[model samples]
Target: MGEVLWENIIVSILAFAILYFLLNKYAFGKLFAIMEQRRELVVSQLDEASKTREQAHVYVEEQKQALNQARQEAHEIIERSKQTSNKQAEQILELAKEEADRIKVDAVREIESEKTKAVAELRGEIGSVSVKIAEKLIEREVKNDQAQEELVDQYLKEVGGRS
Candidate 1:
């Protein structure tokens, strides 16, 4: 039994040493290299994710700037349109005022011309009536010059009152 025990111990120790050496030289190196490669892949993927996040942030900022610029341009366009409309309205108002003034002046001139024509016609009628009255008085027999003059004055007064 003692001899068997010694043999068993020696054999177990030798086997353990040999196994440790073999794993250290071959399997352990390959396993560690594979683990390192996996770690590097994880790190590179993390870096790529960070870069993509930054690019997305930049894109969002650019979109915001573009939206702001478009808003400003739209505001300017609306303001310009308002100004143009106001200017047009002013021009139309001015033209209307000018036309009204022209019409009023023409009406006043026409009224003056008609009034002048009416006055001239009245004067001509008065002259003809006076001439006819004088002819009638001359045809009638008169007693005295003073009486005829008085009758002529009275008739002239009556005609002037009627007119």
Candidate 2:
């Protein structure tokens, strides 16, 4: 019975070695190759994902720069408009002032002309009154020189006072 037990033990050990050798040569090699292929696929996918993430970041940055540039251009346009509006306002004010000055000059000229005309008419009336007075005195024919002189002095005084 002891010898049979020892023999059974040896046989079992031999069977385990053959099975391990066969699995290492055929089944384990294929299994390991499959595992290596899966690892390489996962690494390539991770690299692709990283590259895509970097591209997305660059796109976001470019959009932000474009937005900032657009805002700056809009601000410049508004500033230009304001400057143009101010220039127009100043030009209008200057034109108005010039017009007012021209009107004032015209009014002064008109007043001066009217004054000159009035003075000439007054002089003509004075001349006509002097002629009529001389004709009346000649018709009266005052004989005394002293009386004529006194009458002339009195008329001169009256004319001066009226003027």
Candidate 3:
């Protein structure tokens, strides 16, 4: 009975040791390798996500720079248009001023010509009136005394010569 009990205990211990060795060599080792591979895959995915995020940020910055450049170009075009418009306005104003000056000069010339014509006409009218008055006075005096006409003509001739 003692030998049989001892033999049974030894067999139980041997079975436990064999089970432990099989689990460590096959099940536990393969499970641990699978877990390590999954961890590495997750780390690689995180690294790829970080790289994609950085690329997205850089793209956004480039777009912003392009937008700013476009805005600046638009502003420059507007300023150039304003400058051109101002220059055109100045040219138009100068042309108007020149036209006005030309009109003024023409008007002054016309007025001066009219004034000269009026003075010459007035002088002719005054001379005709004086001649008429002198002729009427001489006619009146000559009818009264025909002998005095010869002496009056000689005296008038001498006065005209002096003037």
Order of candidates by lDDT, top first?
1, 2, 3
lDDT of 3: 0.84
Predicted candidate 1 versus true structure: per-residue lDDT over 77-121, tens digit per residue? 999999999999999999999999999999999999999998887
Task: Give me the displacement of residue 59 in model 3, in angstroms.
Answer: 1.7
Candidate 2: Cα lDDT at 132: 71
* CA deviation > 4 Å runs, candidate 3: 1-37, 142-163
In candidate 2, list every pair of residues with a backbone clash: none
Q: Candidate 1 vs. truth: CA RMSD?
A: 4.2
Q: lDDT (CA) for every model shown?
A: 0.90, 0.89, 0.84
Per-candidate RMSD vs. true structure? 4.2, 4.8, 8.8
Output the worst ten-in-a-row residue range by lDDT, candidate 2: 1-10
Q: Pick the candidate with the highest lDDT.
A: 1
lDDT by residue for model 3 (119-156), tens: 78766765765576577677766555665676567556
Worst 10 residues of 1 by lDDT: 1-10
Displacement of the residue 13 alpha carbon in candidate 3, Å: 7.2
